[model samples]
Target: MPGPLLRPLPILFLTRPEAASARFAEQCGDSGLRFDTVISPLFRIEATGPLPDASAAGGLIFTSANGVAVWLAQGGRRDLPVYTVGDATARAAEAAGMRAHSAGGAADDLIDWLIAHTPDLPLMHLHGRHTRGDVAERLTKAGLTCGSAVIYDQPAQPLSAEARAALLGTTPVIVPVFSPRTGELLAQERAQAPLLVAAMSEAVVNALGPLHKRDLKVAARPESEAMREVVSDLLKRALAGDY
Candidate 1:
């Protein structure tokens, strides 16, 4: 007699923009996790105004990869030290020839690092329009003399038809949300399919606003590695017939 057959894990619905989604897919592959996936971005990053003058600034702050992309495209100076909120953004900055340092993750962590380092010189934060924490303001209040420039705009987008159909299916869908903004957008979609949310942080889980109560898990840390671990663990539990 053969052992009991195992059930396939739920499909993953990736809501990050094209580039980021591709990176996540690559990570899943590298981790040896296989699952059907749908790429549906809820926001589009668009370059905005001219790059701000950073010639006199002490260093640069980047909270998102989009901001780093915009700054690089605008031909900003790459010699200055680049402070980032996560490893991905730091990698982007380094690829553009900048000396980059990651604060692990989260704006508060970045602010704390800046305070401890005491760069003292004026720091310019290159960011998108839909940013959550005011890194510049927080740093300034701490006597760091930080300023910000909106170099990109994250225009809202909607779920694709394929995404909607997948979300309505009986099979559970694992949605990994990286930001509070993304979580809010997912909540508004009101997907009725069985869902297991992998939120990057507690703030992201809270941003879901009571969507599905029983199927949400927050990452151990506000980092991509932690998010991936949460996703992998949830997939294992789901395959084992454990909710």
Candidate 2:
């Protein structure tokens, strides 16, 4: 007596940079959710090297892990006090032997932390090409005497063939978007399958705009672990056909 077979879980589409998306896929594996993953980076992170001399700067700011990696690659000094947007970036900075503090949220949170704690004057924000929030500008307005440097560039990249196929197929697809820029790029594409999205923040969700998503979930926090939890929840919902 042969019984009916169950359908496979939805594809987990990751669209961060190559390394970042791969790391997230690994995290999903570690969390016991082995859904098939497609790593199609929406942005290629290239280091804009020859970092500016920060001999006069007293503090450092990193809004993304990519910035931290580029900084380490460029032999940027780590002696300055470092503030980061999320725990992941702080952890990356710490791994590089820097004294780093996490705002535990987004750029606004980092700015608030700087305003409250008032770190050393003439702070420098090391970031990527496509960035928002104007961290250094806002900080300087708040009387923090902050400056910024473009350390890397995240130019737009086309989704992989596999990603495009998954999006156009009948099988379900689950996408966990980490940044607004990723969301913006994804919004430009069309999906035929049932698409579920797990966004890292309100900004990400907003950037997703008018995508015809079957289900959408926002992480409770801006950290990577929070996004993972949201994805896990979406997986359960997808399996149950709750979307």
RMSD values for the candidates in order, in angstroms, are 2.1, 1.3
Q: State how far residue 148 of model 1 sits from its true place (Å).
A: 0.9
Clashing pairs in 2: none
TM-score of each: 0.93, 0.96
Give lDDT tens digits, candidate 1, residues 52-96.
878889899999888888888888888899999999889999987
lDDT of 1: 0.85
Clashes of each: 0, 0
lDDT at 1 for candidate 1?
100
The model with the greatest lDDT is 2
Best by TM-score: 2
lDDT of each: 0.85, 0.88
Error (Å) of candidate 2 at residue 84 is 0.6
TM-score of 2: 0.96
Residue 59 local lDDT, model 2: 84
